[model samples]
Target chain A: MDIPSYQDMLAAHERIRPHIRLTPVLQSDHLNALSGARLFFKCENLQEPGAFKVRGATNAVFSLDRDRAAAGVATHSSGNHALCLSYAAGLRGIPCNVVMPHTAPEAKKDAVRRYGGTITECEPSTSSREETFARVQARTGSEFVHPYNDPRVIAGQGTCAKELIEQTGGLDIVTAPIGGGGMISGTCLTLAKLAPDTQVIAAEPEQADDAYRSFKAGQLIADDAPQTVADGLKVPLKDLTWHFVSNHVSDILTVSEQEIVDAMRLGWKYLRLVIEPSSAVPLAAILKNAERFKDKRVGVIITGGNVDLDRLPWTEGA
Target chain B: MDIPSYQDMLAAHERIRPHIRLTPVLQSDHLNALSGARLFFKCENLQEPGAFKVRGATNAVFSLDRDRAAAGVATHSSGNHALCLSYAAGLRGIPCNVVMPHTAPEAKKDAVRRYGGTITECEPSTSSREETFARVQARTGSEFVHPYNDPRVIAGQGTCAKELIEQTGGLDIVTAPIGGGGMISGTCLTLAKLAPDTQVIAAEPEQADDAYRSFKAGQLIADDAPQTVADGLKVPLKDLTWHFVSNHVSDILTVSEQEIVDAMRLGWKYLRLVIEPSSAVPLAAILKNAERFKDKRVGVIITGGNVDLDRLPWTEGA
Candidate 1:
């Protein structure tokens, strides 16, 4: 499998600039005081369709040849990526078919529908998802857009960290949540080329510590039955993602479910920004290990804000 | 009593430029779809202390004499204004006291404390609030900062509109909620001069539409029994505020409690920003009368985002 290089990531940024939003990097005095870190939050949570997934999705959609684009696009995602790809495809005047599991949050499903994507519900299993997506591709003759394994997608996601580095002078450490490891891998790739000394840390929930364990053991591991409030982090580690994580990532830190909830609440109470549990992992990790980040310039990628209001982490304050 | 002219408002913008945040102007496509009008949201909800009240408070704090600043500042408010003044006073190294009504939300009281303000609770009546505040001022020798009536405060409030007009080129109309009319008066003064063709409208909850009735009656009419989810808009219109509303305001529109709640939900669901009912009034009005503003470019001031999480509007959705 061919891996994307630093130059490819830079090229992808240029390719996706028109399709992707250069999301704002917000400075938080309150958050800075909380951890003693001069923190710059790359607010990907506020990106188009409320996630950084749009960057990769836009890049993938736009990179396709006119003939391929005309054939349409297909993907399987339970959350932000599905909606993002659908939205990006719709913008490019192409049809999108998303194979979302039945267990996916209603809010996400609604967003995908709103973006004019045809949805096919599958059982909550990788085999089921793959089989269903293949059927979708066969039925519609659409090109399958891999969520993260694809080099173009990884390079596209790297643009977020590129913008972060440009927006802030330089970050001492960059932290992002690792699920399928797309965001973190992209972030690490950008940081490696732009500022090699800057640490690239992957934050993951303890319940779903596949990336964390894999990084520590130097071998890919999959969390078969991950249990966490962060539904987005349930996807198991992939080989390409593991390769990116093993080399470029400096460390992987695990945060508790309670910590994720606390971070989400803090984002809402202090930042006045709604963030999903998956996005909270990095913040939770920072707060848990304040000593590691104190007096340093840290960048946190707020992955997404597509939270289900019904199942919100209201239990924290309760 | 001297009313703030458009010129005075511009001068206020100059005065507070160094101290206050020129808050972000965000366009909501989802709201535009629902409202018919292309809605530009001036996000004062993300302002310092999470409300537009900080604009006036900061101006008041900075404008005070050295002697007056040393003596300190005091006010009575149910929430945002008191906390805003407390924060502004804290910045200037001055003592801040808030004589809040006993009925004020705990979240509001907590915010005041977080900003380092001493709270003195009084009975939930105007006479009681005035009497308590007067006693506190007499005992502490702190300059009393009225929530809305003061000219300096009005000037500070006007700066928001001035900034909004500057950010949005020239809006066809500007809408803000009217409680004691501090923000609306400032908004009208700024728009009436800078964007003369811009319609300056006030959105009030139908349950607490004293300003709407008074606008029509051409006389000051207080709500004998005000009831609305928007706690900030319960106050009666003051003399100085009435003068501006009577003269410069194009019209006052009323929105139902349901509409206010729905608008607040939409703010969270679509914009992914938490907004208080008061902030949602303009949006509520827009949603209710989409035809009235067809093709018009509308500027809506989202006043605050300080709602209690325990009592989130999503509970109703559940």
Candidate 2:
């Protein structure tokens, strides 16, 4: 797999600038006091499609040539990426075909449809998703845009960190929740060139600690159907994402489900911002391991604000 | 009761500028489409104490003379006012004594204590609250700071509308939920002088419609014990607040309990904001009486965000 350079990230920023919001950077004195760190939250939750996924999706959709753009884009995601790609496709007036799990949340399905994406439901498995996506892509002759692994997508995600660096005037460290490592890879890509002294960290749920395990083992470790309340961080890292993670990440931290829920509640209560469980992973890591971040200025990326309010993770039986 | 002038609001803004945040004005394309009007939400939820109450509290705390300042401040409130007063007192390094109902939410009491205020619990009634507050004031020799009736607080609340007018380049109408009429009076105070052509509106819960009744009757009408899910709006208006509401408000609207919950949910879902039920009242009015605000540039003051997460109104049996 080819690696995207800093120039590509810069170009992606220019391409997607008009299409996405420059989400605000928020601070909480209470959160800072609790964690013993000066934390600046990059609120990607305020993104147009309600997640950082819009950066990469918009970049991919807009980077296409007219012929490919007319053919449209296709992706297999039951999460924010599906909805975000659909949003970008709608913005560009192109067709977006999404392959989602049959058991996906109704809210997620509704969001994709609302964004004008055509959805094809598949069995809830990697094999079924890939098989279904392949058939749909072939039938529609649409370009396949991997959720996080593609070079264009990684370059696009890097724009978030670029904004973070600019917004905070550099930081001692920057952290983002790692799912398939799209956002973390983008952070690594930007920090590696723009602010090499700044440490890049990845946070994940302990229930789905494949990224942490992979970092410690010095090899990519894939998890099979790991369960976690942070539903967005259940996927394992791919080669393109692992390339950045293994090489550039200073550390991979893990937090328990209870910690994630507590952090999510704290973000809502103290920060007064609507953030999802997946977005809470970084703060969970910071609170659980405050010694490492003590007195340091940390930039924590809030990845999204897309959760089923009816079934919050902290609710009984959720 | 002496009425607060625009000059008082200007001075209040200058005094509180260094302490309070200049909250952002957020626009929602989807919300505009839903309501058929351009809405600019002044995000007071992002204020230091997680509500707009901090503006008035800080203004009052800072406005005190040295002798009175040394004596500190006291108030009787069951919601955001108690916590905001505490926050302001903590900022100014002064003692803050609060008399709150014993039945007030534990979270609110904890917040007040967290901000270094002394809480004196009273029975959940106007007579009990007043009797307890009188004793606390006498014992502590603190300056009595009425939650909404004071001129300093009214001036302080007016700063929010001043900021809103400046941020949105002169809105056609301004609206806020009327509790003791603190926020609405402030909106009236500012708009009446700064943009006299702009209409100032007040929203209230139908279950707690004392303000609506008073506006219609052209006289004060206090509810003995009104009930509403919006705990912040249960209080009746005072003479000073009534002065502004009566002289400047163009209309007073009331929404049902279900409408408040629906508006709160819609704000959380679409605007990606964590606003209290009281703050949602203005949006509820806009949604219900669309023709009144349709095609107009409206500034909606989101009064506060201090809701308990575990007991969200939308949750089953909540």
Candidate 3:
């Protein structure tokens, strides 16, 4: 994998600027009062298509040649990535075929449909998703936009960090949730070039800490059956993303599911912002290890706000 | 009642600048797409003490003389106002007494306690609340800050519309929820002076449409038994408030309980912001009568985001 540079990230920001929202970097007075850190939240949860997925999806869609673009786009996602790609494709007047699992949330499905995306449901398994996507690609000859593993997507994701640095100067540390590590990889690359002094930390839930274990052990670790409130961080670390993380990121930390739930509730109660469990990963990390980051300037990437409103994490507990 | 002009609102902005947040004006791309009117939300729900009640409370607290302020403050409220006053008083190193009904939500009671407020729980009736507040004031010699009846509070609330107008650049119309008419009075006063072309409309839940009825009948109308999701709009229009609403407010529209529920859910889902039923009134009114404001630049004031998260309005069907 050719690692995208800061120059590439700057270009991605320019490319996706028209399609994506430069979501506000909210300064949390309440959180700051609690932790004694000047925390800036990169609210990607409020981004277009309801996630930072748009940054990557939009970059991928526009990166393709005119003929390839005219041929349309396709992806396999049961979450924000699916909705984002669909929305991005619609903006560009290109067809979007989202192959989602049958068990995908009704809200997510409705969002994709509302954005004018054509959906094809398959079994809720990696093998089934791949097979369904291949079949759809073969039938339509459309380009497949990998959710996180692709270089173009990773470069696009880096644009989030680019904006963060531009908005809040040089940060002491930057943290983001790690699944397949697309967001963190892009974040690392952007920080490595722009503010090398700023430590890039991978915040992973303990239920699915494959990325943390892999980074710590100096080897890729795959989870057969991972579990966590942060559904977006369920995916295992890939080779390309691990390469970026290993080289650029300073450390990786894990937080409990309970901490994630608490952080989500705290965000709503204090920030009045409805953040999904996935978006709460960075906050969970901060709350769990407040000592390490006290009095430092920190930036937390809130990845998305697409939660199952019917079954919130807090209610399931006490 | 002395009418607050745009100049008074400007002064109020300067006075409350240190205490209040210049809450962001957020846009719901999805809602705008669905409703046809380009809707811009003034996010006062994200204000301190978890509501715009702080704006009025803070203004009132600071407007007092140092000697009068040393005597501390007192108010009767079910939740937000009490919490706001307590928080503001705590910040100013002064004492606060809150006269709350025992029937108020546990969360609000907890918040008032968290801010070091002395709670005086009374029966859930106007007579009881008034009697309890007066007794507390007589005993403690604390200054009374009426939630909506105070001109300083109205001036402070009007600063929201002042900020909204500055943020959105003279909206076609400004819609705010009306209870005691503090926010709407401030909004109307600001709009009437600064942007006379911009209409100011009051939104009320049909279950407690005292303000709406009064606006139409040209007389203060208090519902004998008002029942609505919006607990904040339970208060009837006072004489001073009624005068402002009657003179300056363009119209007062009523929305059903279902609309309020739907708007609250939509706010949580789309805007990723936790808004209470009272905050949803403006959005509810917008949905109920979208045809009236079609293709217009509409500004809706989100009154507050404090809600009982354990049992969300979204889960409890309309």
Candidate 4:
């Protein structure tokens, strides 16, 4: 496995610039007062396909040589990455084949289909997802882009943090919610090279704290599945993402399901942002541990906004 | 009433630039495909207090002489204007008093209080609001800033359209949801001078179509307290707003309650914005009457985003 450097990140950024948005950085004085920290929300959620995953997906899709592009691209994701890759592939006039779990949000499934991706449904388990994706990849002979673990994908994701630092000028701390750690790894990769003095905090849901536990134990902990209101954070970190998380992250914080839901509502009311539970994890953690971030200029990465509006966390089982 | 001129709007733009966000203009390819119009959404919903009403309110609050400002500011409103005035007054550290109806959403009422604005509730009728407002003004000696009727407020609202046209370079048509006609009048005011070729269209709910009827009749028509999901657009156009609307507006379009609700959900699903039903009105009108705007660049001002999250239009009575 190769580690992508800052130079690779810069190259990937140029490769994907035409395909992704330089999503705006948002600030809420109301939210800043709530935690005694100035919060700069890097709104990757505003990306046309509604996620930061577009950067990575677009880079991976656009980087393929003409012959490889002709074969198309394939990926297995719980949600956003599948849709984003499909969007990028569609832009490039190529096929995108996605393997998604049966339990994935209906909204994400619809978005993937809207972007012209063909979906193969698998049982809601890691083994099933891997097996299904393998069969699809074998049949199509498409270039496999791992959701977060690929060097090109991580380098592509790094562009978001690079933009965040530039947009805000600088920040004392940068926090992002951790699922498979794609966003966090990207943050670490950028900060370690560009803004070494800045701190990187990874937030996790208490019910699905594999990343948190792994951070404390000094190793990658695997979780096939972990049920949480923050559906995006159910998966565990991959090896390449673990390399960055283990070396560059300053802290790992966890928050309760209720905290996540409360933060989600607060984001909608105060930020007027339609954010998912995963995007709320960093905010929930920040408010929960205010002292650590007090008086600091903090950048909170709003990873995605592809929420299942009908089945919001606050209205579970309604 | 002295009409606010294009020069007055320019002064208001400069006066309120520091206080208001030059809100972003967003475009959605999906929505454009659906409507066959290139829609430029001026996202005033992303304003700090979550509305374009802040533009007028900030101008009104800040324009007062020091001696008059010391007496503070007051207004009667259904929702957005009340909270926005409160937000503006809070910024200047003045006593902001507001007269609101009993039927206003809990969320808006809470926002007014959050900004330290004292709310005096009255029956949800024009007469009751005026009577209640008079009493409050008499007791507090606060300067009256009529939501749309005042020249200062109209001038301030015009800045939104000025920025919208500047941001998009130019548009063939500009559309906004009309309640008391503050936003529409502003669009008309700006375009009549800056972009005379640009047509201004006002959208209204079919259930509360006073503005549409008034446009057709070529005279002011009033709706005392019509019921609609777009709580902000229940009020009638005032004398000052009518001056601009009667002179510059090209057409008035109305949509059904169902159309409004569907557009609101589509905004959430596709735009991923937590927009109020009022903000969805223009989009609904455009889709319902697509042939009129086909292949043309249209600027749609998203009025506000201070929505009652728990009681979304789609989840009513859940």
| Count of backbone clashes, every candidate in sequence | 0, 0, 0, 0
Q: List the candidate 3 regions with Cα displacement exceeding 4 Å.
A: none
lDDT tens digits by residue: candidate 3, B1-318: 576566767787888899888888888888997788999988987786788888878888887889999999999986788888998888888999999989777778888898889999998777788888889999999999888888877888888888898999879989999988988988887888888999998999998888888888888877643777788888777876877898899999999998998888888889988898899989889888989789999999998887888867666642
Ranking by lDDT: 4, 2, 1, 3
TM-score of chain A of 1: 0.96
Question: Against the true structure, candidate 1 has what lDDT?
Answer: 0.86
Question: A194-249 in candidate 4: lDDT tens per residue?
Answer: 99999999999999998999999998888887888787888788899999999999
Candidate 3, residues A1-318: lDDT per residue as tens digits?
777777878888889897777688887677888877888888888875788989989999989899999999999885788999998998899999999888777778888998899999988767788899999999999998988888888999999998999999879999898888999999988888888899998898999898888888998877743767787777777788989988888888899988888888888888888888888888888878899789999999989888778878776644
User: Could you report the DockQ of all the candidates, in the order they appear?
Assistant: 0.55, 0.69, 0.68, 0.77
- On lDDT, the leading prediction is 4
Candidate 4 Cα outliers beyond 4 Å, as residue runs: none
Task: For each candidate, give its TM-score against the true structure.
Answer: 0.96, 0.97, 0.97, 0.99
- Top candidate on DockQ is 4
Task: Give the Å error, residue B92, model 4.
Answer: 1.1
- Per-residue CA lDDT of model 4 for B196-305, tens digit only, reads 99999999999999999988999998888899999999999988888888999999999999999999988887777889999999999999999999999999999899
What DockQ does predicted model 2 obtain?
Answer: 0.69
Cα displacement (Å) at residue A293, model 4: 0.8
Q: After superposition, how far is residue A233 of candidate 3 from its true place, in Å?
A: 1.1
Kindly report which residue pairs in candidate 1 clash with one another: none
Candidate order (TM-score): 4, 2, 3, 1
Lowest-scoring 10 consecutive residues by lDDT in candidate 2 chain B?
B223-232
List lDDT for all candidates, in order.
0.86, 0.91, 0.86, 0.92
